[model samples]
Target: MPAGSSTGSLLQTLFALILVLAVLGALAWFLKRYGPKVGGGNANVRVVGSLNLGGRERIVVVEVGNEWIVVGASPGRINALATMPRQDAQHGDHGGTNAALAPHSPAAHSFADWLKQTIDKRK
Candidate 1:
């Protein structure tokens, strides 16, 4: 191939690679932002609440089907801490949505307190 033709082909290949990378980056961003909502109303599983215990440790409450589950999540693994029937929030049930699912005080629904109760029950 002529020198000029080879250079032209190289530029075209570089442009194609750059375009592909840009498209991929945009796709990743789109997924990160809106992917979770894709299931929106139809999805049975939803993140009802989350609490960060430390740098990489957290307790997350998720509602799946008609049940609510407490999950212990870390950088490495996720474990189910507890599960219970879904509480109705709109009808004045104290278990509000989102972060409200967990009370700030050392209340009955707090993770530690709940865990203690559960352990005591098993005895």
Candidate 2:
């Protein structure tokens, strides 16, 4: 093949690949933003909060109707860890001040603190 024809073929291939990637990226973003609400936002089931446990595992707190459920999620499986009534505010305080009152630490309580306190209370 002539040098010019080879260069033209290479350019065409690169343009086609770039177009496919752009289309795929747009589709992915669209799906991630709008996919979960397929059942409609009126379903009354929503994720209140989530904590990553590394890799694909995490703990997700979901509000289903008037109930709050703590779920352990990994890959294809999900397990309920705890269930409680949907409180006006998480951590029992209606004022939304569930943070540790330590002067040295930040006012906002980390998920670890909340998890530890919840576990200690159980014991």
- RMSD to native for every prediction? 6.8, 9.8
Could you say which candidate leads in TM-score? 1
**Can you give the lDDT of residue 6 in candidate 1?**
95
RMSD of 1: 6.8
Steric collisions counted per model: 0, 0
Q: Candidate 1's residue-wise lDDT over 40-101, tens digit each?
A: 66678888767788999998878899788989999889999878777666445445332223
Cα-based lDDT at residue 90, candidate 1: 48
Q: How accurate is candidate 1 locally (lDDT)?
A: 0.73
Estimate the TM-score for candidate 2.
Answer: 0.47
C-alpha lDDT of candidate 2 relative to the true structure: 0.72
Best by lDDT: 1
lDDT (Cα, 0-100) at 39 in candidate 2: 53
For candidate 2, write residues 70-99 as lDDT tens digits. 799999999997766664555565422353
Off by over 4 Å in 2: 1-38, 90-111, 117-123
